[model samples]
Target: MRPRADAVLSEWFGPSDGRLLAVPMSLRGKVVGVLLALEGGPGLNVAMVQQLTYTVGLMLETLASRPNVPTPALTPPEVISGEPEVAVEAPPAVPEEAPRAVEEVSVAAVEAPPAVGDGSETVQLKMPIAPAPPAAVGRAPEDERKHEEARRFARLLVSEIRLYNEQAVQTGKLTRNIYSHLKEDIDRSREMYEQRVSAEVRADSNYFHDEMVRILADGDADALGV
Candidate 1:
């Protein structure tokens, strides 16, 4: 019946422009939570609410699965302007006759120079090998996993949009007036994609737009008209 909260609330608690709706959010086959929406003005239609909750679940689950990225340390305002007040502890006083332990270098541990067995004998020093690039070696697998998850999530979101609006998508492609036909839907979907996809993934490539053009527009990007 009347699920919007404002209408029911206004009758007893005075006039209110607010609206409320809640839809179940499911990830895979499990219902994890509910999408609680509150608006001071107009509310989305039932179809939009359902579609939104579905995508919200997918996005939350995917994001939760990604490894946490460390945030950069920020300098405080006092540090920038001037040195902030800091307390320094004085080191404990040592005995006047405290003997400092000095480590003796073992000469035997060092390799001896090559003996001059032959007149043509020459010595070659081994240069220290440079360390491998940390980013390339250490982060390669993590980066690959991140990109894979990003691409998969993008594909899922675009596929759902295409699946739900199949008839409209087809008609829009034929008429080449997709913007007019589904401007609101496409705009909202793109907004969701932008919001859900991390900056790292976006910097690499916009897979959402790629899939949207490929699936919804039949590989003809111009068909979507943006």
Candidate 2:
């Protein structure tokens, strides 16, 4: 039976078929059903077969233990199958015509200008001048040093991540001839971590440089006093 199943799985390599090679379904650590696929190429390898068998077994065990409950038959079953099930909650409502407090501003009154020397009538116009915007505060010297350190660390981290990714790819190619989900997960985690670190570096970079400058300024001031 196993040999015939294997042969059938191998036959799945035919161009006409586009199905899975083999799917072994199990229940309670035992083979309850064998899903022999007749699509796709070259059939299942020993490892794939083993993994599939295990996965099937786990699923069957769960189903077997689950209490039998009459599930509501979905109306238009095809629609349910075509689209994934997801619940979206409505966003909170905002109040209309929100209350607002009024702000009062004071304006200085200007006196009229005196008549000109020729006794001709003079008109004086006063325009309110706006205050200058505050300058952006500079970072401290210690902050500057920290920024530099962070930049250096970030570079090192990126280099290490690339190196590790390359190593993982090479290792997968040599040992398994295919990259596994575990390797993909590791790569994803590393990428996310790097992004987070980069954000932190950008946010604090200016302050880091400022701190270094402050330290240097203090040293110079002390030297001048001496």
Candidate 3:
């Protein structure tokens, strides 16, 4: 069976050490995809594959039967075919010639500002600068460190949640229904992380959530490196 190129499982297993177990996830005799796991020992055999397949099948059947279940947007595999070979003759090469020399133009110096009453030029050099707020200016290093820790954890949380969602989709767990099971845990963790950071930064709890949403939109979960 061919897996989509953009699939996380495909990309992940594209490079491996050769010891792997792939169990086909099927429902109603229709093969959806495969659930890949690293081979552990003798326990990783046909029986294990069959059991996993049955479990995945049950999940798919139950979720598919649910009303208003959301469909996952997994990458679908495309068909690959061969193209006819066309032999083309090479074009004759042209002779190389010496390149022409380029002329350099000199730039004029910026003129001085108009002279003031004292006969001195009043050069008002405008710079792009903004004043730091009192809260930010007086923030302790420990507070900054805490805030950074919070941001990093927030990114990690988003990355892990996305990874979980993708895995659920692969195992036939539709998000609209299955995700509600994980929502409370994710929200509690998020609140705790936010509270810890807010204590240090002296800010409202909603600020961290806002920051996480911004990070999520920008796909800045690189901190997790997953």
Q: lDDT for every model?
A: 0.53, 0.35, 0.40
Task: Give the TM-score of each candidate.
Answer: 0.38, 0.22, 0.29
lDDT of 1 by residue, 1-226 (tens): 1232345534644453444444544333344455544443456454555545445444554555555555444433343333675655555544354333322111111121333222211112111111222243445776767666666576566757755776788799998866677777777877887787778868877777776776577677899786
Tens digits of per-residue lDDT for model 2, 91-155: 55443553332211111122223422322222221212222223435967655544544533333
Shift of residue 37 alpha carbon in model 1, Å: 33
- Model 1: lDDT equals 0.53
Cα deviation at 3, candidate 3, in Å, is 17
Write the candidate numbers in order of decreasing lDDT: 1, 3, 2
Which candidate leads in TM-score? 1
Q: Note the clash tally of each candidate.
A: 0, 19, 0
Indicate which candidate wins on lDDT. 1
TM-score for model 1?
A: 0.38
lDDT of 3 by residue, 167-216 (tens): 44223232223334445545776777656556635353344444333322
